[model samples]
Target: MAYKALYRTYRPKDFNEVAGQEHITKTFRNALKSGKIAHAYLFSGPRGTGKTSIAKIIAKAVNCLKAPTDNPCNNCDVCRGIDDNTISDVIEIDAASNNSVDQVREIRDKVKYLPGVTKYKVYIIDEVHMLSQGAFNALLKTLEEPPKHVIFILATTEPHKIPATIHSRCQRFDFRGISIPEMTKRLDKIIDEEKIQIDSEAIKVIAESAEGGMRDAISLLDQVVSYSEEAVSIEDVHAIKGTVSNEKILVIAKSIAENDTVKSISLLDELIMDGKEPQRLVDNMIAFYRNMLMFKNVNTDDFEQLIYKNEEFQKLALNLSNNLVFYYIEVLNKALHDMRFTTNAKLYMELAIIKMIDKIEKQEIVFEDTLNDLRSEISSLRSEIKTINTQKPLENVVKNKEDVPESKVDTFSKKIINDSETEEPVVNEHLIKAKEVIVSTLYSKDDIEEEVPNTVEVENKILSSDLTEDNNVKSEEKDIFNTSLQEEKKVDNIVKYKTFDIRFVEDVLNNGDRELKIDMIKKWYDLDRFATVDDKPYTKMITEGRIVAANSKLIIIEYESAAVCNRLMKKDFKEKMKSLINKFYNSNLDYLALPKSVWEEKSQEFIKKWRNGDKDIKLTPIKNSELIEIEEIDDEIEDMTPDSVKEAINIFGSDNVKVKRGEN
Candidate 1:
């Protein structure tokens, strides 16, 4: 009459009243009706999953005033007394506290006694796994050969801890966690009977938060009812659980789609500061994206089926690419998994959001590249048309042995080289010969020496010093050679990193030893030892990559993502990995990390050439003192027309000049 929690007040008195556990209930009911009750029974499952409640019901059903009944009629005096805990025949024990051998021995000694007010004396032991080994041994004999009038019900969350000797003697029943729909139905019934006004969505939130435990669901429902002034809303559930609303999750998704890193992170910080759980936030975001993806693929007008149905959500589903949504789910799922091992959950979520933003930026870059490709194609077409117009008159002039200007010959030669088609048209032999002569004349060694005197001086000094062993060189020239060597040394001393290098892959393949790769792979299991420290991020990154090729002096690792490859390519990461591997494998071996896509392209090329009987493969080793870092650059050829050629083309005029090839 004072105050009882929903779980205690609504405890099922009959076997039929329990939800989501019809299998165990039906079995016990049929057994009780047929008088086939076991002398000792063991029930094991998760907490708050009706293990103890069902144990009590079994005791009452067996001892009810009216025998031969499948369930206890609470109207009877015997059932009422058992329910009120005033009966002497039923004994309930918390084995967690009374887990000594003496306690179990006392139970064994009392099994011969008759029931005082019921048909059978029942002993209910909770958390039976907590009993000591000696206690289990003491109870084993009694359980194996219990008196006809005695009944024992043992309940435990962890059944593995119970000894096999005891387990073999009892009837074991494993209870499963309540399903979501079943839990929601039970919670709905409680809310209806209690006359509590709450939104249907709020009940679902509570059920989900309970995670398949009936008692937990009821407890959360009771708490929410008490906290709300009137009808409980979904917001109230979110507030109680420290999770964000569906609308907030939508906003975060939009921010990510827009590549707004600052906004996404700011919103995340606010939620974390407001006592919202980072793990729950990531989960909700993942669900949001998942629903959006479903909406795109599934033909459903009922917005109720999805978690979010607002206009903003619809727009996002319409606007966001399917690929981006998939990536979002992947990143959030990884963050959710990683958050369990770290106390700083917020950091991981923030990093995940940043990664999504970067993905969006990369997508935009791809789109821009596609547009540039279209423009390049159009320009190439126009140049082809101009070539057709100019080549006609040039062919006629060549047939007549007309004296063409040197500029005109250069223009014609450039067009012939720039043509995309493989076949060359008929042209005057003299014009081709003159073009070759002019190239030799323009780029003579004397001209190069005048342009870059330091380079020529260094080359001359190096040859003279090498031939004479420094005896024929002047003191001034010797100083120049030393300066050159010092400069080269400086360049070689700078350390660098690259996102991907074909040379690295090639070097490993040329010297790859399958036996060495297998040996190193067997030793990769030792990597787990480095995982305990926080400073070894590269170790974790290394685990993400696979050892595709290996040799005594070099190794090639392939990763699924370029982002990971880029991270592993940092100067500090390289040094740490090199030192770690050297110490770990007891070898001074260099390693390369390449994205799977790049590796596939390059390795396939190598295989094709190797299959064609090309055995001249070579290794391009990275200097230990310097590994040059190259930024990702567009590989398309750049314009490199010589000044003289450009001047000649201008004199010939824009219309007369058709297509002209740029020097490499």
Candidate 2:
């Protein structure tokens, strides 16, 4: 006897032994128990999912000496012979190598013969999609109407390639990939029986790396056991698979979050040098950050679902914001995509690391700048408080009673107290009370004095100064108002544009008139002929865009350059182009402009939605009023009657159009 691979040594012997396929197994058991087996069966799904194993099991169960039993009695001579492949009744064919009309004809001829040992003959063809067209034709009638004692089982990973006529004749059983938990349990059974010492996490790692395939998982476990000196570990699995360990991934992520570019690149170089793949490293990093984002958003105690479940990783998750985690995932995902096209994935990974660090540093700088601004504001507020506290009191100004009128001083003090009581309540109660105290102290009854005589000159000086200040303020305000008015008029001339509404684009794509679009596209080439020197640049802008969609009322254009698209979206440019189209094509149509890349993306989405028949996504017409800006020219045009329309146009340099008196 020779040593065998773990997957082969532990192949499922019966329906009960198969993992994660209870639906198919249970159905087959019932069919076998009732003796209602189909003559031909088709099994399809991903590789390593037990399609072939289940086919063999069905053959054994149906051919068992105890004829009507669901489970095979392995002790029977017939079952024993079939299991060991000594029996001529069960035949397994690899269609990859034996895919020819002659080979299929031989099977078709042989299927008519009775089983040598068992009651029925079973012909199992694996990878049946590899069979040629001629071979399928030859096998069609035989597979459709095989002998009463014959059973034909076909299995393929790609079911789509199988002919529909063949598919219609057989009972199809789709085998799904085994889940991680199920694979883990099966591997544990193998490990226990073989008495292989291994860490539980190592088994988990192997299961995850297998990617929903039990055979691959078992094979990985075997390789790890062979490579290890003693107990297998998670590091062993990562090393074998060229994947980064959770700890290393955590360190790299922390380095990125800390903006330690040098350390991150150093670790990346070390990993790549140690035979870890750059793409795999990027994938693991992305997974790490994705797990972090999940941990940040979801509240669960199950650490098994996450790649990194340590306390330090949790702390990192808390420290990193959800937005930053999202950004990290985005960068790494882009790197993963870019790495597939290039040979030098190391450069892309380094660039991605640098980008992440740059983002972190920029965010930190912005935070520091915000902090400095807040500090400056607090300092200014404190300085204002100090200035208010040091101001001279009113009593000091009124110490010379003859220099000021006593009745006037009493009136000023009374006004201050009255205003404080009637004014909006101050948020700070202490400030309000402080003003009251100062007013009461200044207007005390004990400090009263007689009114001074002949204060006419002082009042005249005060009145003259006040009048001069008022006149200066009024003159300044009038100048500012005129300047602002002129600026506003100039700004209004440059018509402002708004971002294109995506809904309008969807409507145009779904309901556009193809003939109208073609007409506009043909007319678009002749616009250069009408271009004068002044309007040539604008005409060129319109001509460069491609008309993507159009109807009687609207036309959509796409420009390769975003800047050109934005310029064409301007109200003035749009209006000028619309007028040109109307004049030349005799159609009044509004224009919508989008960048080429944007149109491609939107068109793809629209096509997908259409294919899915998404009733929830319905298109509605965009009113021309919503798309167009009706701007009024506020700049005054010279008033003219119909008689002087030519003179007015001449004076305005022949660029202005003559308007009727009432229209103006």
Compute the lDDT of residue 599 as modeled in candidate 1: 62
Q: Report the C-alpha lDDT of model 1 over 88-112, residue by residue, as the tens digit.
A: 8899999999999998898888889
Output the number of the lDDT-best candidate: 2
Report model 2's TM-score to 2 decimal places.
0.58
True lDDT of residue 48, candidate 1: 84
Clashing pairs in 1: none
For candidate 1, give the lDDT.
Answer: 0.75
**Deviation from truth (RMSD, Å), model 1:** 22.3
Off by over 4 Å in 2: 289-308, 312-330, 360-664
Name model 1 segments beyond 4 Å from true. Answer: 257-259, 279-345, 360-664
Q: Candidate 2's residue-wise lDDT over 298-387, tens digit each?
A: 775552453646888989988877666877888889999999999999999999999888742244333334446657765654454334
Per-model TM values vs. the true structure: 0.55, 0.58
In model 2, where is the ten-residue run with the lowest total lDDT? 447-456
